[model samples]
Target: MKRESSLKRATTETDVSLALNIDGSGIARISTGVGFFDHMLTLFTKHGKFDLNIEASGDKADNHHAIEDIGILLGKAFYEALGDKAGINRYAFQFTPMDEALCRTCVDISGRGYLVFDVPLTREFIGDFETELLEEFFVAFTANSKMTLHIASLYGTNNHHIVEGIFKSLGRTLKTACAIEAGNTEIPSTKGIIE
Candidate 1:
């Protein structure tokens, strides 16, 4: 059986489609109106070693809604694909650095939506994409996936590097957290369930 889920979402402002594999080699095919954001997501999937396919088109008037909605859809796909969340590692963390920027990301599929963002920067826009939209995306992803996510950019000068490091780190951490543990047929938590 394919341990994967395929999903699509549509609104007046955006049309999004996604295919996700919980376990696979890093490979991605992605497109969005915003080039840089698409690059980031591709890098995230590539470095995290996930097989992902995404396509989205949004209103030219605003990229925020499209970007954030994609996150929500992707997160929902993850939860649906994972089913009962049994026999999974359940937690993961990674610290990644890009040029002068360093970021740490940690995640837990705890059935509670929470995002702790610590990126402190003055600028709200990264090229054509809004930096604030990154937070919005993560928030939507967390809520839909019912996962607790923590992302921190401890130090960075360039916005590009900071954001890139965070996404890549998040990808790696998530890949680690979702791996199946050998000889373990139950959830990874002591509470007998992740949810």
Candidate 2:
């Protein structure tokens, strides 16, 4: 069976449509009107080996709302795709490096939403993408996905590389955590249920 989900959200601030395939060949089709964000999402998809498609539009004032809403939808799609979470690894972590920057991302699909983001970005923006929105995206995603996510920038100077490493680590981590384990047919939890 294909592990996939899709969703669409419309609010006063933005409108976002997203589709995700947890088991895929790393194909991405993204258009958020934020070039740098598009690049980040593309790389993320490629690293995770997940197919993702996103189309979003936000207010003319800024693109923050669109990205955050995308996070919300993306998280929902993942939750829906995982279903009962049977046989999934359920926990994973990754350390990714881009140039001189390194980031660590960890995740646990315990159906309890939490986030611990500690990336220090000095730059206010990466191209047209605001650095502040990076945390917002993860925050929104973690909350909506009902997962525990911890991201830490071990070291980084270049803002672009720092952000890239974070997203890449996140992608790789989730990819591992969502994988189905061989010969394991039950949920990977002692509680008998994730929630």
Task: Using lDDT, give the best candidate's number.
Answer: 2
Q: Per-residue CA lDDT of candidate 2, range 8-123, in tens?
A: 99998898999999999999999999999999999899999999999999999887889899999999999988989999999999999899998999999999999999989999
Identify the runs in model 1 with alpha carbons over 4 angstroms from their true place. none
- Model 2, residue pairs in steric clash: none
Tens digits of per-residue lDDT for model 1, 20-94: 987778889998879889889988898878888999999888888899889998899888877777788788899
Cα lDDT of candidate 1 equals: 0.87
Candidate 2 residue 65 C-alpha distance from true site, Å: 1.0
- What does the lDDT read for residue 72 in candidate 2? 96
lDDT of all the models against the reference?
0.87, 0.93
Q: What does the lDDT read for residue 114 in candidate 2?
A: 97
**Local error of candidate 2 at 111, Å?**
0.4
Stretches off by above 4 angstroms in model 2 are none
